[model samples]
Target: MRKSFIYALLVGIMVAWGLNVTALKILVDHFAPVTLTALRIFTAGVVVLLFLWGSGQLRKVSWNEAKQIGVAALFSVVAHHFFLSVGLTRTTAANAGLILGLVPLVTSLLAMMFLRHRLTVFRLLGIASGFCGVVFVVANGDGGLGHLSVGDVYVFLAVLAQGISFIMIKKATVEARVMTGWMLVFGSVWLFVLSLVLEPGGVSSLKDGTPSLWMIFLASAVVATALGHMFYNQAVQHLGPAESAVFINLNPLFSLLGAYWFLDETITLGQLVGFLFIVAGVVLGSGGLDDMSARFRRAKVAAGGRKVGM
Candidate 1:
């Protein structure tokens, strides 16, 4: 029963995050990217605070923790979202979703570089395939392999920033709930200030926006940010990080389907091929094959032992 519940929760998380890309794509059409990001982060931060306070988990963040959180916030939330927002404006959500699927591959490379993790042959192949997939996608979708679109570059940069934050997050000691809330707070402040300077009159544009615009904003803030994070964190607690992480790969699939359904985005042959490569690379890079081998060995030994006992 517990296992079933966790699996269901995992699916929910995947759906929330998957549709999140689609929501952002829609929201960007109604609001400026930075401005939209700022509003979403701010609203989510308030929800986090309220939840923490209600649960008696709210506490003063120490200076050291605050500094760590700040560093993570800068890359993970601020830069990641900034680039993602800008990139989405220039590219289709389907393209963005497929490109972002390389996060695991990038994170693996970063882990090897910063944490002294071993780089295996499988991972190397994974990296190569992932890059080739990106190149193919760019060449077919944008223009040529050599002439990458600005949006693609921005999305790649967003992935890089997110990868760095994934590394930095390992060094932090704060509780996940507290850290995430603070990260949202810091990200909100950073982007809000940025929006003010770079996107003047963006906030006021909301007043004239349609009901669908407000609905997307509310959904992005409440469903995607607040509930998604909460459910994901809960799943991590119940399922452990490794098992929970496998579900994250479903995020791109959701985004791809959602984009097709809502935005009427078409997935071409090249994009589909690229998507396959990226998913395979991510799985291989994350040691799915090694894990399967280990599990098979265990199962074989267990079966052999049982036969002998019989």
Candidate 2:
């Protein structure tokens, strides 16, 4: 019961993570890519620092732990978020999130190589399905991309960067303590510098008033960036990213839902198909029919003497 509950929470976090794509897109007019990303990481870092201080774990991180977290910050939070945010600025978040769903497949491959995780057939198929879905998105649901828009290509690169990060997170979260706090602090500082370098008007832009300007930044900082990644980090520690990667499938789903609420975007059949492909990929990556069947049995047992009442 507790496991299921935690799983649901993880799924919720991933949904928020997915929804953040649209939220950032809405905010892009207010801040440049680096600016918003810097804000995102900095806010999350501050919150996380306060959290560590409160928990009394701030002083517990060793120097070796610091280095691991630093690497995690550079790859997962700094590099990945910068690339993805900049890419999301160019493409619709709807398209970007769907494409980024390929992260699991990429993570799976990287895990096999570096982490010594075995590559199961199911995961391979999921990876393939994810690529197929990407093709559909690029092709506009016809078959494949006829020609690449610079924006589309950038978005795809974002997907690759993020996918690699996911794999790294799976490993770092496994062995490295203070992974979350280190990532938050270092990533925030790096991003803030990047924002300063890239943004023409710099912090002065924050004073410009659109109705949701600060609200957008705050929500992204508090809800989407901090809370979302916090939940994800915990889930990785608890669930191992192999199972947890399935939670990422919720991203595109939440992207659509959030867009409907915030941007009044219409959902389309092609996107729906894209969603299915991602789901298919995740299911495959999750270890296929045999693995899912076993999970069902476990969940059923974990449900206890009660029949789950579902």
Best by TM-score: 1
Candidate 2 structure lDDT: 0.71
Candidate 1 lDDT for residue 205: 67
lDDT of 2 by residue, 4-51 (tens): 988889877877777787878777756677776777777877887677
Which residue pairs of candidate 1 clash? none
TM value for model 1 = 0.92
Query: What does the lDDT read for residue 122 in candidate 1?
Result: 82
Give the per-residue lDDT digits (tens) of candidate 1, residues 165-210: 8888777898887788889889989998999998998888677778
| Residue pairs clashing, model 2 | none
Per-structure clash totals for the candidates: 0, 0
